[model samples]
Target: MKKSIVLISLIGLMIACSGEKKESTEETQITEEEVQNIEQSAQEIDAVIDSSIQEIDTLQNEIDDLLKDI
Candidate 1:
């Protein structure tokens, strides 16, 4: 009958849609974890840059003192 065919088609459609929803949720979770890891790495790099700048400033000051003595 036409009614049975339509019912079966609806069931199939629902099952297919449900599968897509799960896949989307899993992908979102993976993206969020990656974003968090990237943020942590960025923070670590910023700290290293700050430390390097401080070291350069100290060396420059020492050089200026030597020049003053000369």
Candidate 2:
């Protein structure tokens, strides 16, 4: 019957859709080496930013001292 065929097709479609959902929910594992590499890169970036800020502060102080003399 047409009704039975339609019902079976819908059930098949639902199963296919549910399999895709499970695949999407599965998490990708990160290795310990990958985590360590990420941490090291972050620390390097922080060090560079801190050094640049210190340099800017030093230059600003020199400019202020010159302006005071003027």
Candidate 3:
């Protein structure tokens, strides 16, 4: 019968459209050495920025002293 055929076709379509669940096969991890390297790089960058700021402050003070002399 046409109705039985249509019912069977709908059931096959549903099974084809259903998604399968999959488990993750591998886990990702960060090593201690990588963490230490990142921390060290951050500290070096901070030191460079602090030194540049101090240099700028010193130059500004020199300019102020020169203006006072004039």
Candidate 4:
């Protein structure tokens, strides 16, 4: 009877461990997907920043040219 109890306890522990592992794997997958989405959004924002900088530089050059004419 004692041996059977021990065996049952071990089986229960194994099942619990497996469940925890599956849950952890699912969480990791979700985190990776979120990271990828954030990276893509950051890249889009960088592109917008680059475009704005170019426009500002062009305006600065035009202002400099007008000053030279004065």
Please name the candidate that would achieve the greatest TM-score relative to the true structure: 2
As for lDDT, the candidate ahead, 1 or 2, is 2
For residues 1-70, what per-residue lDDT tens digits would candidate 1 score against the true structure? 9999999999999988886343444443467879999999999999999999999999999999999999
Question: Which candidate do you rate higher for TM-score, 3 or 4?
Answer: 3
What is the Å distance of residue 54 in model 2 from its true position?
1.0
Error of 4 at 59 (Å): 0.6
lDDT of model number 3: 0.97
Error of 3 at 43 (Å): 0.7
For residues 9-57, could you state the per-residue lDDT of candidate 3 as single tens digits? 9999999889687889889888999999999999999999999999999
lDDT for position 21 in model 3: 75
**Cα misplacement distance, residue 18 of candidate 1 (Å):** 38
Pick out the ten consecutive residues of candidate 1 with the lowest summed lDDT: 20-29
TM-score of each: 0.55, 0.61, 0.54, 0.54
Off by over 4 Å in 1: 1-30
Worst 10 residues of 3 by lDDT: 19-28
lDDT of 4 by residue, 1-70 (tens): 9999999999999988886343444443467889999999999999999999999999999999999999
Which ranges in model 4 have alpha carbons more than 4 Å from their true place?
1-30
Candidate 4, residue 26: Cα displacement in angstroms equals 14
Give the candidate number with the greatest lDDT: 3
The alpha-carbon deviation from the true structure for residue 23 of candidate 3, after best TM-score superposition, in angstroms, is: 12
Each prediction's number of clashing residue pairs: 0, 0, 0, 0
